[model samples]
Target: MAGIAILLDLWRKNQSFNAGLYSARTYQSTQFFSASAAATAATFAAGSSFASRALFGSQVAYSDAGAALPEDYISNIQSASERVFKNHALQYSTKQYDVQLKPLFSAFELRTFALTSLRSFLMYYLPLLEPRVNMEDDDDSLEDNQEDRHVDLVVPFKKSVIQIIRESTVVTTRRILERIAVHYVSQRMAWKILKDVPQSAARKAGRQMPTLVYIYCVSRTTFRGHMLGVAASWIVQVGIDLYRFFTSGFKTLQEDDDEKQVGVLAQRVSVAAVRCISSLIFASIGAGIGATLIRPSRGQWIGCAVGDLAGPVIVAVIADKYFHVTL
Candidate 1:
């Protein structure tokens, strides 16, 4: 019995010790699990906060932080292009109008104008020296045809004289206006304005192009070259019209009638515009045909001059004959 009791005591002591150890372990494990859970929650919260902040920062960077919209980009491009065009135009004008650096008149211009006037005078006078054509048309091949002879020789003579005077007056007026322009504009600009259309056309004809394209190029070149002369002629015509309008007492009576005045001005402008366009078209055609036929320079010059002179007459004749629309 003693031995049995001793064994029981040892067994009970071992069991109590084991039970204490197990309880301690269980408490430690529970504490560790709690700490782990807290650490994991804190880490999760920090990660979530960081992810949300990143998303918000990215949105701000895209929306309001130095980011350009499509419209802003296009506006920038347009502004840059406009600046470039403005600069180019300024540079070109500067080069063309460097008046202080160059003389207004040169010997070449004077000689050329003199030659032109002399040639024009001869063109008119030489026809008089030739045998009087029985027919009015110079192209009439049958000079021997007595049936087509003019009965009134005095009328034809008067007509010739009037034409010569008219031509001389035109040349003088153009020269005077050209010199006046030289006073305000640069020599280069003035020269360009008065440039020979035929010479320019001849030069441009070197390039091979379709017939229609060639004609168009010639016409465009001629128009540009003759712009100054056309403008001067239009100005003269407008001045005359205005003078007549004022002299007729319309200005005094209709002083308050701004609409009437504007209408008259517009009508005059339209007439001038039509005439100018017709003259240019005819001149361009002449230049092209002349350049193609005769020696480029001489042919172009003669053709252009003839076309410039005859264009208005032809238009007038056509209007009177076919359209009954007097210009």
Candidate 2:
């Protein structure tokens, strides 16, 4: 019985020792789990703080870029616009002042003056040089009549030649003056007023503009461009008319009797005035029409000249037909 009791006590003590070892292991496991959890929480908090700082810095950079981008774009546009306007202004100024003129006494002009003088001389002098027959010197009365008639005709022929040459000179002078005025006085303003007829016509045609509109535009442009030319022509024509009137008046006063001279001077003056006005009007109209039709520099010149020549004839025809008067 004592041996059996000793064995039971040993069993109890072994069981208690096993229970204490289990309790210690449980406490150690719990402590390790708690420390691991605390470390994970601290790591998570640090990562969150870093992420927030990075996000905030990115937002600040984006906002700065957003604000700066529009300002930069606007500045670029403004600079580009300024450059374009400056270039346009420079080009306009250059084009405005660009003008070229021929020398005053150019070869073509000299030739023209020479030809005009020669033509005038020939027209006046050729009729006087009739194939003369060697007649007997004893025909005194016949010779005297021939001399009187020759004297009367020669003076007029000489004066007519002089008048033509003078007119030609005046025209040549006027052209030079006009060029000078266009270059120095009016400058680019005149060029703007003057149309480039062929180019303008072509542009208008491309746009399908009407013929009447083209004609009107071209005519108006021609008139504006040749205003000085027209004025010069009028002055010259009026001067010529005055000269002829005075010479004719003097001749009439000498030849015609007192009764016939009463209203003849006044009538001649009126005729001269009518002729001058008719010439100016018709000339302007002709130049316009010619420029419209021809569309070239030479065309305008030819038209003006033809108009000047035909003005008197047209006036005479109209007067003779409608008014029963000869100009």
TM per prediction = 0.42, 0.49
Q: How close to the true structure is residue 163 of candidate 1, measured as C-alpha lDDT?
A: 49
Off by over 4 Å in 2: 1-94, 99-109, 125-160, 172-185, 189-210, 237-277, 291-301, 320-326
Clashing pairs in 1: none
Best by TM-score: 2
Q: lDDT for every model?
A: 0.59, 0.58
Worst 10 residues of 1 by lDDT: 99-108
Error of 1 at 175 (Å): 8.7
- Candidate 2 has an lDDT of 0.58
1-327: candidate 2 lDDT, tens digit per residue: 223223433543465455566654443443333333333333333344445535554433333343344445455555665676676688787543545554665423768767777777777767777665646667886777578565357675776777666667566666676576776766766564444544544454456556676556555555555555555655665566667666666776655453454465457657766766666566556665675577545555566667767988999998899999977
Error of 2 at 169 (Å): 3.3
Candidate 2, pairs of clashing residues: none
Q: Mind giving the per-residue lDDT tens digits that candidate 1 earns over 1-327?
A: 223323433553465555556654443443333333333333333444445546544333322222233455445555665676676688787454332212333313666556655665565556555665454555555654555454555655566655444444454556666667678876886666666666666676777666667667666666666665666567667766777666765536755565676677778778777787678768878876776677667777776777887887888789889998776
